[model samples]
Target chain A: MFGVTILGNNSAIPAYDRHPTAQVVTLNEQLFLLDCGEATQMQLSRYKVRRSRINYILISHLHGDHYFGLIGLITSMGLLGREHPLHIYAPAPLQGILQAQLDVAAIVLPFPLHFHALQQEGVLVAEDKFSIECFAVYHRIECWGFIIRENRKPRKINKEQALAYNIPGYFYERLKNGDDYEPRNGETVKNEWVTIPNTPGRSYAYCADTIFNPEVAAKIKGVTMAYHEATYLDNLIERAANRFHSTSKQAATIARLAGIKQLLIGHFSSKYEALEPFLTEAQSIFPNTQLALEGVSYRIL
Target chain B: MFGVTILGNNSAIPAYDRHPTAQVVTLNEQLFLLDCGEATQMQLSRYKVRRSRINYILISHLHGDHYFGLIGLITSMGLLGREHPLHIYAPAPLQGILQAQLDVAAIVLPFPLHFHALQQEGVLVAEDKFSIECFAVYHRIECWGFIIRENRKPRKINKEQALAYNIPGYFYERLKNGDDYEPRNGETVKNEWVTIPNTPGRSYAYCADTIFNPEVAAKIKGVTMAYHEATYLDNLIERAANRFHSTSKQAATIARLAGIKQLLIGHFSSKYEALEPFLTEAQSIFPNTQLALEGVSYRIL
Candidate 1:
């Protein structure tokens, strides 16, 4: 269940049935919001993603299209009687903006809001299940990217081998946690006897709102899946560079250089009504590129 | 043509097929946005309303469902390269919130932003074609309703009578302005001889997020069309009162007592999946009642 669902894929202005930047990274039952833009909550409702399960929000920058929907989503969560504390990780200035909006509306949340200002390139959240880290990106303003690494799963049990060893079905849950089996006859079985090691944990990196920078490839090197902003086509390479955005070719180049297993490209400019050209252009450079479409989820593993 | 286009028609939470409150008051080529909520810009785009033509935005309250989309719309307008100045009318606290967001985002609008805080019950805007007035409403927070009154039109020209008078075709425009005609022979023609009095101008009042207050009828007396919040049906009268909201029956009663030609009831509570009951209940009280459907325009002729 380690996947990312696209809520909106358009760039600054939402057009042509495309919305601004917003995504939901799903890990089992937990959901983490990435860059909540306008209509993010509506998208969540439309896509049937449980808003109550979204306890953490990661905002890349202070752009209005990136985080304008945060206030409304937070307020709606309060109205929905959410008592679970919410955590928001963004640039430092977001706290003042959120506070002013809450105070103006006289909204006293039913839950506490924890704000974590992203300052340097380091881990923002480290839990037993996963960890999220931030890295710098070359944008017009100060911005950062995020990488989420899910913790490695425990060994898988061989049901036939476990049955032969007289292990009850109830003990399977503990066995998956790398616990050794103990029979009533005082015979202790090693964990390796009936279990096989799990594959490596998956990692996904989100390179938000960046220009064509080679450093990005080095920062997100060797990720299982990578999402890059391809705001323009190759024809608008100069425009993309001037606006601190990346072209489809540029995004693909970075993904190919980083050796990512898959590249999800989005944040498309509203000018391009047809999206086929983006896929065609990126695929010509990197065969593993995929278009980030609304309501579509790309599994990291 | 003067009309009111419904953008959203639900209460605090957007659910089912209904959205939060938002409307566009159309006056010929210009538009006046009223209470922009979440997904309002999307609604505007969906309904094919020219967002660039919207020069004025009126927020009735500080509720997130009423004004959360304002900042997004403004930012989008800037991104779309709007050069015309935009006017916004809301409570005083909204300025601080908007400013903090803009400061953090470092967004300098290409167009000027004119902010008018709604402090008193008086005329907020008075133009040659129309005038807008604000009045207090009974809500949980400080709120106001708006009245858009079209200016008195000139006399309608009688074509046959003008032809008999031998008036030139070029003089018809002036004749509609109530101008007298004179021939080269120096014989003055009276305006009444070739013109008839124009019909009375139309007035529409928006009673935003209010309780079942009988006093509201007096404030919006004699309006051509009136829109009032019907957040609940007759069965939830007690709940409506507790939440400082009006039921469908209450809304219709206010419209009937105000001598309105037609009543438009909206701001439906999201708890109800079906909306036909609201219209049925309101029409039973006021025969000229209509349910405000999104994307539908109610012409005031």
Candidate 2:
């Protein structure tokens, strides 16, 4: 199953039992950690996320709220005897930070940590099952965003159609994947006659801390699911823009402009105790908007 | 008001709702944080600790469980615009680590942070009200422990005796501080006649991470309270020694040998779930032993 779980939704400061930004994106058997905040390790335990399965970590920036938990999580992974190679994609400076932290503590990780400094905004990882892409965002300092695209879905098999076509049972496997079957009798059976078209591949976009920029929308247009930062209410539009953050309405505007299927809004400011205003405001512009609550999983339909 | 609150009790990994080693020592109005582990900031919030009120942070070692949350807490303090100077006492390498992290993120702290490298085992801070001292411990790497000594307690003023002695209200304040009252035209009244002796100011010692060493007891003898790390049970004594940790019985032995009035034992290994066995084993050797439960305050009487 493919889904995204919110580990922490708060911004810079941890308040109201809400933590800083961190999320767990599970695609098949692999888990991708996007922006590990200070509480990421503990939150992973709270949400029962298998740490060993997290093969990739994508950090948007060097901001403390975005990647302070990287060293701790990596240390714990070492302590747990994880041998799998962990790949980290982040800003160029993170490699130095991680090295200094580990060197000072004399920690030798048991796994091979491949640090891929995100210098440009493009594909970071491309596997047979999925692909990951990064893009630049307008922020106070150097920052970036990420989007994950899953592999194409398999064609659905029609049992009645397959039997009616008199195709051999052994060829049904290929038929379900849109492959034409040719019997020894010199008769060709078209794939469309036995299988129906399944839905296309799904995509999830993570727009890390950024201002109200339509370019962000243009980069990740028509995504199946998108998580946008709504750091403030509509009333604080000026305050949000001045700090290089976005308000609920601005996030919703981007979602509406991008024409995405669903919008998940989070990165709430510590000043606000109630998140209902953000959801209600965002939903006015984007009807399929939902608050990114901690521990709640959002699956792209 | 002189008490120690446990923010985290677990040793290396966070388990069973327990975090790593972090404690809040409240001395009158001042709060001193000891060994900030991964969840220190969140645990501080969970227990309603005023983050701004903490003036001193003491880190014993460079272990991730001992000081992983240092940067996060400092960053949060900076974001909150704390102007008062914060003092951090840890090993020398931590300064480089902190500098690298702050430089990469371009975070200019609002407050002045004074980093005091712990080199020699001696007095780190000596004030009129309290004194903080550090000592070396037996760990895998270079580690140190801290002991806080409060100033002498004031004499309790005996109201009836003061009235009988004809001491004026203005002179009572001085009398409580063990000062003899000299009237304008009369003979001096002895301090003992007006005031009775109060209990002496208490002392609390923290033995961070160490093997079973009898010298630890000799260093902190007669302390009002002492907290020692007990990473395993008595059966795992060999394992504890190999890891440079202490078993429950060993921690209790040190407490008993030191003749401390009370003992608070923590730093439990993640392998154990139920803590009752630890309490039972420690109490068998030291009757005044208590499990260092998170969020609970243990006052030094």
Clashing pairs in 2: none
Which regions of candidate 1 deviate over 4 angstroms?
A155-198, B155-197
Score residue A22 of candidate 2 by CA lDDT. Answer: 98
Tens digit per residue, CA lDDT, model 1, B89-208: 999889888887888878899999999999999899999789999999999999999999988788898889999989999998888888899888978999999999988789889999
For model 1, how big is the CA root-mean-square deviation? 5.0
lDDT of 2 by residue, A34-92 (tens): 99999699999999999999999999988899998889899989999999899999999
Q: Score the docking of each candidate (DockQ).
A: 0.57, 0.59
> Which pairs of residues clash in candidate 1, taking residues 3 or more apart in a chain or in different chains?
none
How would you encode candidate 2's per-residue C-alpha lDDT over B178-227 as one tens digit per residue?
A: 99988899899999987899878899999999999999999898989999
What are the lDDT figures for the candidates, one per model? 0.92, 0.93
What level of docking quality does candidate 1 show? medium
Q: What is candidate 1's lDDT per residue for A176-264, written digit by digit as tens?
A: 98999888788898888988889878999999999999999999999999999999999999999999999999999999999989999
Instruction: Give the Å error, residue A33, model 1.
Output: 0.9
Q: Candidate 1 versus the native: TM-score? A: 0.89
The TM-score values for the models, in the order shown, are 0.89, 0.90
